[model samples]
Target: MSAPASPQELRKLIAASSWTGPTAGVLDGYQQANLAVVPRDLAFDFLLYCNRNPKPCPVVAVTDPGDPVIRLGRTEADLRTTLPRYRVWQRGELVAEPTDITAYWRDDSVGFLLGCSHTWEGPLRTAGVPVPHAADSMAPPVYVTDRPTHPAGRLSGPLVVSMRALPGHLVARAVEVTARYPTGHGAPVHIGDPAGLGIADLSTPDFGPPPRLEPGTVPMFWACGVTPQLVLPNSGAEYVITHYAGHMFIFDHHVDETP
Candidate 1:
C-alpha cells in the first residue's frame, strides 16, 4: 500500500489497521514520535526521567491521566489506537504486541510522545546526506548501549541508540543536518566503533533490523526513543505500553517546531 499523504491520513490509516509498517518516510515534513504509557503511580518518575535524559527521551506531547488524546499542539491524536502497533508489558515482560490498546487503557494511564529521529530524514535528504533506512524502507537498527541513563525515582536503565550507516564522506553533513533538530536527538552520540558504546555486534540488535552498510561507510548512532521501553523492565512497573519499534505517532509540526 502507498504511504499516507498527511499526518491525519496516516493516523486514520493506522487506526484502521491499513498500515502497519515502519513510519520512516510517511507524512514527510511532519514530526514523528515514540509513545510510552505508564500508570499514574509512576507517571511523575517517568516524566522526570525523560526530563533528565532529554537526548533519548525528548517529549513532544503528553496525555493527561486517563485521556487518550494528547492535549498538545493543534492536532487531536489518540494515543491508544493511532499508532500502527502497540506493545503491552506486564512488570517489564512484553505480554502482547497489538494494533490497538483501547481494551487495556486505564483511567490512571498517562501517555508520553517522545521525539523520533525519523523526523530528521527529510532534512538529511535535502542536505544531500543519504539515509539508508529511508532508501531501503526499513527501520534503523536499535541497540541497547552500555551507557546508563540518569535515574529518577524507580525509572533507570541503559541508554538505547539507533544506528544508521552513511557514506564516510557524508557523515559530517549528516551530523550538521541532524544537529539543527535538537528535540529529535540533536546530534549523534557516537560516530564510529560500535564497541565504544558496548554494542558487541552490528549484526545483532536489541530491536529493529540489523545495520546495513556499504564499503567505506560508517555507522552513526543517535539516542533512540525506544529508551523508555528498555527502562520499563528496570522500573518494575506492573503495566506499561509503548509503540512498536519504528511504528510511531506522526504530528503536524515540522521537526524544528516546538510541540
Candidate 2:
C-alpha cells in the first residue's frame, strides 16, 4: 500500500499497532528519525557519542529526561507511542519487541531522535536519482561494518550502514543531491564494493531483506543512525529502548531546513 496521506496519519496507524513495517519510503518530504531511549544518567555521554559520531547519529531533537513529548519548533511527538515498533534491551541483551512502550517508559528515560538516511531519499528522487527502494514498504538493507566509531564514555561499537543500489550513471548526481541534507546522512559512505567495508555477502544483511540490484546499478552505503543500536548493546547499558530495524519516527521538519 502507498504511505499514509501525512506523517501524522501514518503515526496514528503505528500507534494503534495497525502498521509495523519499515518507514523508508513513507510520508515523503518529511524527515524520519531513529529512536533511542536511555537512562537519564547515560544521556550526556550518549549525546557526546552522537556529537563525536555525527554521520550515523545526526541529532534531530532530544527530549528532556522523563518527558515523552518531543518538541521541535512547532511539531511534537510522543516517545512512548510514535514509532511503528520498539526494541527493549536489558544490560546488552535484547528482551522484547513491543508495539507500544508505555509500560516500559521510565521517569529517568531520555528519548533521542537521530536522523535516518530515509530522510533524504525523497529529495534524491526529486533530483532525478533513482532510489527504487524508497517507494516501497520495504526498509533498505543494513549491515555492520568493520569501521569503528569514536566512542564516548561507556559506549563503543563498529559502524552500521544502510545500502541502496543506484544506477551507475546517477551515482555522482545522487552524491551531490544527498550531500545537501547532512542531517539525513548526507552522502554515500561507500560507492563500489561492499567487501571494503567487510561485508561478506550482499545477500545477507543484519537487517532488512537482500537487495535486488538492477543492471548498471551500484550499491551505495551510508552511515546509519542504527549504529547506536549496536553500540548500546556493546556498552551494556542497564536498559534501553530503540526503534526496530527499518521502522522510524517521522518528524514534521522538511529537508529544506537542514544545513
Best model per lDDT: 1
lDDT of every model, 2 decimals:
0.87, 0.86
Which pairs of residues collide in model 1? Answer: none
| Weakest ten-residue segment in model 1 by summed lDDT | 250-259
For model 2, residues 1-259, the per-residue Cα lDDT tens digits are 4568877788778787788887877777788888999999999999999999989989898999999999986567787988989999999889999989999999999999998887788888888887766666667889999998998999988999989888777889989988888789888888889999999998899988899977888889999877988888767678999998778898776767642
Superposition TM-score, candidate 2 onto the true structure:
0.91
Worst 10 residues of 2 by lDDT: 250-259
- Tally clashing residue pairs in candidate 1: 0
Candidate 1 local lDDT, 43-129, one digit each (tens): 999999999999999888788899988866767888888999989999878999999999989999999998888888999888888
Best by TM-score: 1
Error of 1 at 153 (Å): 0.9
The Cα error of candidate 2 at residue 165, in Å, is 2.5
